[model samples]
Target: MRIADHATWDRGFPVKYLLVQEDEDGVEQLWGRCTGVEGFFVDPVPPPREILTLRGCRPDGLLSEVLAEPDVSLRCLGDVCVEVCDDEKPVQWWTLADAVVVAHQPHQADPERYDIVLGAGVRSEESFFELPATSHFELFAGTRVAAASAGRCSGVDGLFKARVDLAPVPMELIGCEPAEPLLAALRRPRRSERDWAYLLVLDRHGAVMASRSVGLAITGTRPSVLGGILVDITLTDGGNDRPSLAARPIWAEWYQGSPTEPNLWAPYDS
Candidate 1:
């Protein structure tokens, strides 16, 4: 899917919709409604009016104070944790690594288990704010990777599954493994012209009920250069306004035990 296709939802600004339901086994299933019509899913639009895309930056390069300026958000999806500033008009964001701090409840059991929470002002070590009463999220201690991989099977045993729908394009999912060097999943044959890639990583979780995707503009794709990839940053006159997801029916059908407004497409699609 072309990056331009994501502008349909709210004009040029895209919104990410999420619906969650529990299965008969009581495990929660998340039905994510994202932008992109032809199988490619871009992260939600950023808050900044203008985005400056940079290509060929070292993936492992230490972000400098100057380059990591205010009002800019970066979109690099994978197992990495991110910090999005909701209060800022331009929403300064960055990939969170050593800066992330997960705290476990004093009496909490199995502190390693966690859930994915997506929204503005999600409390992290680097970002903190007073959340509105209507907000829903979970704060627990564990590595971001551990949270994403919990309650799933297959892949690297304790690893998590990453379902990426960037069709008609070849992309790689690379990350580090326990006691092993950096690893990259082999690019599998596309199931169809609209197929999504499923790779394994040691990562989001039960506590993590939701999180917003990043807005990205990709002019082209090429292999990583010096462990870095390049992108063209587009800037806009974005305001400080934020968008909230309302509960909506994912399907018209209603089951006996379904809520008044059913949000999940089906209980078993995942």
Candidate 2:
């Protein structure tokens, strides 16, 4: 299983790697031992790096840019990605088979900078990141892989098939923007304005904001789908407990409004 940990600048440099093994018995064990590791800003996300967007990782929806060199296998991603979830199990877990390896180039050359664009095409709607199955998968670079040749991808264009057993990446509701581009691609409905609710789904991390409000009859993010017209948040004060926000928020009172996009709405059969 691949384990993913955020590289935080404020935390320190040279991010560490931890490996956990879960046998058939369901027993979990921890493994920690790595060397010559380092990281920096991934761009777009935050400093510590929450969501990584490697440009041109997977240029084509279904193809990976074969490395121009040899001995460069796809296992380069340390072979696994542990998403770093909390005590609670992650929302999703799955394996990726035969993915593409867009391209590779040393960062600093001398010391060898390995961070490169890692992309995967979406094959199933049941994919993460409300983006879609056809969208590319984003990832951060890790450990070195030892394959056979480190040459160009002309001879073996589609031969460098890869498998990524991705573990869930830890994610929290950090920010939410009232508008988004993906939000513009949802299915809206026409109603009395009293029967709808606003919903937010977090399958994979968002490319832009923490959350985007998309008006639609079917509300879903990636793995999890939620639908409604409103989301209610309440804060309770002193009790036997310290000040904290409620674990669950209440949805809005019954709402009945047609899904509107500025001045347009999908036509409904009356």
Q: What TM-score against the true fold does each predicted structure earn?
A: 0.16, 0.17
Give the residue spans of candidate 2 off by over 4 A. 1-97, 107-113, 123-270
Mind giving the per-residue lDDT tens digits that candidate 2 earns over 153-196? Answer: 11112212332533222221111111222233232433334222
How well is each residue in 25-124 modelled by candidate 1, as lDDT tens digits? 7653332222211112223332222112212222222222212435223422222333222333323223322222121111133333322221221212
What lDDT is reached at residue 163 by model 2?
28
* Window of ten residues with lowest summed lDDT in model 1: 176-185
Best by TM-score: 2
RMSD of each: 24.0, 23.9
Superposed Cα RMSD, model 2: 23.9
Residue 184 lDDT in candidate 2: 38
